[model samples]
Target chain A: MTRFALTVEFDGRPFMGWQRQSHGPSVQQALEDAVHAVTGERTAVHAAGRTDAGVHGLAMRAHVDIAKAIAPFRLMEAINARVRPAPVAVLDCVEVAPDWHARFSCIRRSYEYRIVNRRAPLTHEAGLAWQVPQPLDEAGMADAAARLVGRHDFTTFRSAHCQADSPVRTLDLLSVERVRDRLFIRAAARSFLHHQVRSMVGCLALVGMGRWSPDDVEVALHARDRAQLGLNAPSDGLFFVRADYPDEG
Target chain B: MTRFALTVEFDGRPFMGWQRQSHGPSVQQALEDAVHAVTGERTAVHAAGRTDAGVHGLAMRAHVDIAKAIAPFRLMEAINARVRPAPVAVLDCVEVAPDWHARFSCIRRSYEYRIVNRRAPLTHEAGLAWQVPQPLDEAGMADAAARLVGRHDFTTFRSAHCQADSPVRTLDLLSVERVRDRLFIRAAARSFLHHQVRSMVGCLALVGMGRWSPDDVEVALHARDRAQLGLNAPSDGLFFVRADYPDEG
Candidate 1:
């Protein structure tokens, strides 16, 4: 058997997130089915991050084991041919060492949240952005986001049903910037709790609208209480941007 | 009575085109109906350009006449509220002189065509961009585009059913630039013949793929026959970006 790593890009609007679920179709199921169609093996595919429904991915990494020895580019083409009409694309595939686990071997993951701040309803960015009718103060959002960077127990910013063993995670970067009518919040870390990025964006949104202050974000982090946090931002704007590996030179 | 000039944006996936048509819904009809719903007057709305079906608009200028004396911003809000669920937006509205016409008063119009030059099927940009699986040499496309600049009888590039009286329109600018996975072809002119931009893009695409030389473009233009040109590019990638008006400032 040969182990292969693939980079994927998908619009997560139609599926039920990344994991294989008995309830509905998913990115994982789609990939697995495509692999079966290509190589006649029902190989399991594992991704670096299991993104939620309505999220998007620019470059997601995954690994799967197959019996056939095929060229990486050919495998990419065959899998893409099988996953047709679905909003998923296998961008690139490469032969990898057997020990490279997509989930565990990843060193870093990055996500981006897009918000279109304008009075008019979004047309082109309908499902791709979180629309805020009122203009947002991006500088204020950035100021609030700065308070959440570095190592901290992000309990208040995590999902209530988060299954992580601990709430402490080191946030490498958190940035907020405005471009034209869109406000982008980009965050990077080794790993994240369920709904952490969305939760943090929701709190920063309140700060952007003057409903909350930078001090309030610090207070929420100190509280370490889920109830102290703002609402979870919708999954529409979130994107799994990239996953980094140690040997990715 | 007050005349309002509005800048509009829309996703043209559902509509027939920019003009009102009896067969199906149109962007013009939607906006006119929305205006009528708000002002209780059936008003005729005129746009700077009549984009084809499945094309998008980043900033389209239009003019509407209403007898009611209403604030421009409030009028925009009311019309937007009335046009519920349509992927159309009124970005800005201002009261203009009654003599101001959306089409006749425009000095220049700009358009952009986006092609995602990649092998994978598009996910986030599924409906918004044309997916070209083959790699395109952007520099080659730009060099070919330069040959089409300036005043020339563009009979080979004009649509066979073009309604324009003359084929001698001067192209102010035509540029091809690459930004990440997207290839943007921006064009500006005082006006265009029907299908002119799409036809030009289609021909340049051949140059981008190294199938046609820059000299071929000049030869095709000199031929002055529509049959000598390439096929019209897909409507999905074309966007009516903006209209220039001297009086707006």
Candidate 2:
């Protein structure tokens, strides 16, 4: 069997997230089915991150094992053909060692959340951004977001049902900036717990609107309780931007 | 009656066009209906430009007359509330003199066309951009676009059914630039014939792809014949960005 690593991009609006579920279609299921259709082998596909429903991916990494030996480009073409009409595409494909795993071998992951701060309703970016009718103080949001960076027990920012063994995670980056009428929050880490990024954005949004202060975020982080967290931001604004693998370069 | 000028935004994917028609809902119809719902007065709304189906707008200018003297902010809020789930919004409203026509009084109009040049199926920007699965030489495209700037007879790029009395028009600007994998083509003019911007982009895309040279654009412009034009690019990627009025500021 040969292992192939693929970079994928998808609109998560229609799927039930990246992982396979019994209820509806998933990005994993769609890709696995496409692989089966192309190679006639039932192979499982693993993603670097399992994003939630309504989230988007600019560059997601995945790995699949198959019995047939085919060129990476040919595999991409065949799989894309089978996955017709779905808003998913393989951006790049590369042959990798058989032991490489998409999820386990990943070293870093990055996400971006977008908020359009304007009085008008979103038209072109309707489902792709979080719309805040009132103006947001981006500098204030940045100040609040800065408090979450570095190593911390992010329990307040994590989902109640997150299955991670520990709440402590090292956040490599947390930044907020304004471009035109949009506020962008970028976060990067080795990994994340369920709803961690969204929860953090939600808190920062409150700070942006003058409802919360920088000290509030610090207190919430120290509280180490999910109830202390702000409202979770909608999944629509979140985008899984990239996954980094060691030894790739 | 008081005359009001409104600045609007919309995602035109579901609408027939900017003009009202029996085939499907139009942006004009939606605005007029919302106005009537809010004020109980039927008013004729006239826009500066008529965009095709699937074309979005950022700041379209329109004028309407209403019997009641309503505050601009309240009128904006009321109309937006009554628009009813449509992908349309009245961004701003201002009182104008009765003779200030939306179409005739406009001094300049600007448009932006987006093309995502990459070998991947679009996910987040499906309907908002034209997806071309190939690498485009942006420098070549920019060079070719410069040839179309300034006053000229645009018959080669004008639609066959365009009703403009003369094909001659002064193009204030036509610029092509690349940001990552996305190509932005911005055009400015006092007025344009049907399909003018799209036709220009279609030809520039050819230059970007190495299918044509910069001189070819000059030759096509001089041809001044519709038959000499490139294919009309899809309307989905075009945006009616803004319209300028002299006295608005």
Output the worst ten-in-a-row residue range by lDDT, candidate 2 chain A: A118-127
Model 1: residues with Cα > 4 Å off, grouped in runs? none
* lDDT (C-alpha) at residue B104 in model 1: 96
TM-score of 2: 0.97
- Residue-by-residue lDDT tens digits, candidate 1, A1-249: 999999999988898999899999899999999999999998899999989888888899999999998989999999999997788999989999999999999999999999999899888788789998876888988998889999999999998778999999999989998999889999999999999999999999999988999899999988999999977899989999999999897
Q: Pick out the ten consecutive residues of candidate 1 chain B with the lowest summed lDDT.
A: B121-130
Cα lDDT listed for each candidate: 0.92, 0.91
